[model samples]
Target: MDFKDYYETLGLERGATQDEVKRAYRKLARKFHPDVNKEPGAEEKFKEAGEAYEVLKDPEKRAAYDQLGANWQAGQDFRAPPDWNDGFEFSGGGYTEANEEDFSDFFETLFGRARAQGARQQSSRQFHAHGQDHYARITIDLKDAYEGATRTISLQAPEVDASGHVTLKTRSIRVNIPKGVTEGKHIRLAGQGTPGIGQGKPGDLYLEINFRDDGHYTAEGRDVYFDLPITPWEAAMGGKVKAPTPNGVVELKIPQNAHAGQKLRLKGRGIPGKSAGDLYAVLQIAVPPAKTDEDRKLYEQMARQMKFDPRAKLGV
Candidate 1:
């Protein structure tokens, strides 16, 4: 999809303050309003100005959009990076405009549809409205799931300054990660969202769980998987080899003539919970290079002595 530089659309610079953004948008809205200007593309320009203001006027949306960096130009081919808004906290519904369909695909791609109709419905109640719930994602180590952990995470939210410029307000929060918590799980923090209206209660903050990519390990549901490298001798003959688990390292038994890609399961060694998952150690054979004469002789002796043909079953 083509990148829509909101700032450029409204004839503003990247560093334009919130007030500048507002004034620029107002000027464009007047110049392009369909009733005032009967130009062929006036209506389209008006819609574009509205869309730009929709994002720029809101500090939270503007902060998230600014993350795309200042190097991007208008109408450039653009795709948002995966999880670009992962840690950003957003309040109210995604897009508050009444005419949602009028927004372009570029807008939809950045901010998804309203999470629920409750936010919009609640606006009708003028007496007391509940604060808008916020959502974000936090990444943790895989070991944090095995053993419950307390982590300190920093989050950024937009704050309007005295000059009406939007600035990011950063705060550090300590969170508890429950044991056996898998990916996609959410931890809720009460009264951590946008402030309420009148005597309404504050909203909540929901943090989605994600595990950092550790090269050695991967998880599926509760089950854990990792490659266990073994010497060629260990694969040829039964032996005990040290394997690393989330909890700790343990000795795993290799079967006689164990082939590469064989899996050895450790019962209840995965994430710790009422119904724990299993840990699979996928075996990979490691061959020693024949660098010296003795090593070469040893390999030559094995090749000559062993009459086994690995491809015999393939009829090659």
Candidate 2:
């Protein structure tokens, strides 16, 4: 998708404050409003101006957009980073005034999800008349998922100053990480969302769970997987070896003649549940480097004595 420079569309500078943004958008709207301008492309320009204003006017949306950095140029081929909005606290999904389809692809790519979510929240609120719920994503250690934990997390929401510049207002909350919680699971904190109108109750805050990439483990459903580095001798002569698990280190039995890429399952060792998931220790043969003369000699002796052809199965 092409990058749309919202500031440029509204004839404002990148550092323009909130008030400046509002004025520029108002001027553009008046100049190109379809009813006032009879030019062939005035209507399109009007729509573009509106789209730009839609994003630039909101502190949260503007702050999130600013994160793309100032290096990006207009019309450049662009794709938002996967975790661009991670940890950003947003209310009612940053609802937009118009249908998402009415905006350009650039706008939709940034705020479309928010618009859809806002629509759902709005629909529900019409009946319940509660405050809008907030949402955010919080990353926790994988061990926290295995063993329940209570952690204090900080979340930031954007606020606009009188000059229209965006600033982040941070708030800290204590959250309980339930044991066996899977990725994408949400922990709802009641009455933490936006304030309600009149006598309506405050909305909720939903925190989505994510695991940090610790470089040692990965999870799929209830199953956990990690590389268990084993020496070549261990692969050849199976015996007991120490292996690391989420809970702790445990002795694992390596069957005789275990090969690289072999998986050793530890039943009921994964994320705890009624039917607990298993942990898979994927074998990786670690070869010691022949840095010394003795090491080189030992390797040479093995190569000469083994006479094993690794590629024999390939029929080469």
Best candidate (score: TM-score): 2
* RMSD from true fold, candidate 1: 4.0
lDDT (Cα, tens digit) per residue for candidate 1, span 1-316: 8899998898888778888988998899889888899989899889999999989988888988988888888888989886677677777554554466668888888875323433553564344587877777788899999999998888888878987777888888899999999998889999998788878888888898888888998899999999999998899888998888888889999999999999999999988889999999999998999999999999899999997788999989
Give per-model TM-scores: 0.78, 0.83
Off by over 4 Å in 2: 1-11, 23-51, 71-83, 97-112, 313-316
Q: Pick the candidate with the highest lDDT.
A: 2
Q: Write the per-residue lDDT of candidate 2 for residues 94-123, one digit (tens) a residue.
A: 565654566888887877777766788988
Q: What lDDT score goes with residue 27 in model 2? A: 95
Distance (Å) between predicted and true CA of 229, model 2? 0.8
* Clash statistics: count for each candidate: 0, 1
Candidate 1 global TM-score: 0.78
Query: What stretches of model 1 exceed 4 Å from their correct place?
Result: 1-4, 26-51, 72-83, 98-109, 113-128, 287-316
